[model samples]
Structures are given as structure tokens and as C-alpha cells.
Target: MSNETPLPLVMLRAVVSGGCDVTPPQRPLTPSGRN
Candidate 1:
């Protein structure tokens, strides 16, 4: 197999800790999926 790591475990930790360092974003990107 090739050599490439996944993007879940690390991402989860990074985001989890990152959130604690900042207030909630003004607002999430916003729901722009529906038409």
C-alpha cells in the first residue's frame, strides 16, 4: 500500500483543543445547502 495517513483522529483532537482557546465563531459557515 502507499504511504498516507488518515484525517480523523488528529483532526478531532486539533479541533477539540482549538475550540477551547476561542469563543464560538460569530456563527458557523451557515446552512447553505438547501435551495
Candidate 2:
């Protein structure tokens, strides 16, 4: 593998580690910010 982290993977990791304990359902990034 190239060793470079994928964008989605990085985002998912951020979301998962960021606030899954506080708010699991609304964890994913908003479309306005994602784009």
C-alpha cells in the first residue's frame, strides 16, 4: 500500500472518535462541510 490515508477513512475515524459517545446518530459530517 502507498501508506497515504484515504479521505473518507480519515473522516470516518474522526467522526467515530470525535463524538460517538455523545451523539452517535448525528456523527457523520454535514454535506455543506463535506463538499
Candidate 3:
């Protein structure tokens, strides 16, 4: 939650505009698995 403090609104706007079909990873869970 700490990381989301700044861009929280951006995220909310994205989901609100993009709809529930979109999916985003939490953290340390890179899609490339490099972390």
C-alpha cells in the first residue's frame, strides 16, 4: 500500500476507464519473473 500512495489515483482512473477486464500484478511478481 505504501507504494500506491502517489499513483493511487492514476490506478483508480485506469481501472475505472479500462473496466474490470484489465488485470494488474501486485509487486515483486514481475511478468518476466526477473525479480
Which candidate has the top score in TM-score?
2
Top-lDDT structure, candidate number: 2
| CA error at residue 28 for candidate 2, angstroms | 20
- Tens-digit lDDT string for candidate 3 (1-35): 75667587888978776763343333444464545
When summed lDDT is taken over every stretch of 10 residues in candidate 1, the lowest stretch is: 26-35
**Residue 14's lDDT in candidate 3:** 83
RMSD vs true structure, all candidates: 8.6, 9.7, 10.6
lDDT of each: 0.57, 0.67, 0.59
| TM-score per candidate | 0.39, 0.46, 0.38
Cα error, residue 21 of model 2, in Å, equals: 4.0
Sequence-dependent TM-score of model 1: 0.39
Off by over 4 Å in 3: 1-5, 20-35
lDDT of 1 by residue, 1-35 (tens): 13454577668868888875443453445544432
Query: lDDT at 10 for candidate 3?
Result: 81
Better of 2 and 3 by TM-score: 2
Q: Please identify model 2 stretches exceeding 4 Å from their true place.
A: 24-35
Model 3: lDDT to the true structure:
0.59
User: Roughly what TM-score does model 3 have, to 2 decimal places?
Assistant: 0.38
Task: Give the Cα error of residue 9 in candidate 2, in Å.
Answer: 0.2
Model 1 misplaced regions, further than 4 Å:
1-6, 24-35
Clashes of 3: 0
